[model samples]
Target: MVSLKSLFDLSGKKALVTGGSRGLGLQIAEALGEQGAELVLSSRKASDLEKAQAHLAGRGISAKWIAADNSRDDDISRLVDDALGKLGRIDILVNNAGATWGAPTEDHPIDAWDKVMTLNIRSLFLLSQQIGKRSMIPNRYGRIINLASIAGLLGSTSTTQTIAYNTSKGAVVNFTRALAGSWGRYGITVNALAPGMFPSKMTKGTIEQVGMEKLTAGVPLQRIGDEDDLKGAAVLFASEAGKHITGQILCVDGGLTAVLSSS
Candidate 1:
């Protein structure tokens, strides 16, 4: 019989999470740490990374933090090198770092589009390539979870106004499929998680401006995603439970994607 603990155990695994200083990334890092994986968290801000590292340490989870902007090629290389130096091996990678800008497609600034595409799509692919080629492919074992969004799978009304973000996330979903197909033979599983209406620093301002009722009312579940919602998905993808799952986008959207509401 397979024990529950054995199914979720990551006792000796080393995991790296980019943009892990706060919000969904931090939550995922905490979840993986609790599951017994040595964690290395990275973000652009040093102070935020230190604070997050302390929070994880207080939970008795050993964690290290690195400050690096994912948009820079050199920084991306340094991040992978630094993580490998500290953890010896990267058994799992959570590509949770991303950014978004709100602007109408017609009026969107060129810089905003460039920034979002570079960080959200290009950087994610580059970092995944570095980890897959340099370590996981050689070792023949690794789990990669890319953080996608509901925006990728469905269209938002005009009020949201983030075409670039939506486009980049769509790329993420397809990228996961392509990578998984190519790497599965090497014992690597690549997947994506599309979260819906999570209240984080990224969405706090929007929620405050638009009001929670307006947001929750649209979701079929009538509630926003919580930290608990992330734990199971993260653990499953990173543990034995998801060994056979690959090239799929798991939507943790509280039934938001299932319903077509004219509200």
Candidate 2:
């Protein structure tokens, strides 16, 4: 019988988290690191990566950061190569680097739409391809965690218009399922986390625009996702405990999606 502690332990595992300089990416990095997984964090801004590295160091979590723009193909290729060179092999890949644009559908800019889709979805595919072919497939074991959103499961609100972000995230949902189906042959488990209203730089505008009271009211839990809300879910999908689970999207939304589903 496998003890729960042993099942959840990730000691000796190596992880690479994209967009890990801040927000949910950083949170997930904390989770993996606390579980004893060696970590490599990547993002566009060196400054932010420095701060994140310092924070992790304060917690005694060993981590290294590679600054690269996931929106650019060249950068993503280099990021994967750099991570591979440093870590020897990547046991976990967190596809968390993303961007968003908010505008009425009719008035949305084409450039903005492209930017969001390319970074949110395209980079995810490119990085996964490199990591899977070079590392996971060869090793026959891996965990891939994609960061999706509750917005992917539902349409945009009247007040907040993000057609590009929504469409891209919706793609992430199906992408998770599709990839899982194809990759399970190699002992790789592909999963996604569709988070709800979390207070972050990305959701700050929407939260302010929609009002906290209304947002919480719609959630059955009557509260918003907090700093540590996503930690457990992230660790579950990244560790041995979730070995049997694949192609699943676990929402960390404090019951917001559930409320919407019923109503």
Choose the strongest candidate by TM-score.
Answer: 2
Task: Write the residue-wise lDDT of candidate 2 on 110-203 in tens digits.
Answer: 9999999999999999999999999999999999999999889989765668889989999999999999999999999999999988888998
Error of 1 at 94 (Å): 0.3
Every candidate's lDDT: 0.92, 0.94
Stretch of 10 with least lDDT, candidate 1: 254-263
Distance from true location, Cα of 81 in model 2, Å: 0.7
> How many steric overlaps does candidate 1 have?
0
Q: In candidate 1, which residue ranges exceed 4 Å CA deviation?
A: 261-263
Q: Which residue pairs collide in model 1, if any?
A: none
Error of 2 at 2 (Å): 1.8
Relative to the unseen true structure, what is the C-alpha lDDT of residue 198 in candidate 2, on a scale of 0 to 100? 86
Error of 2 at 175 (Å): 0.4
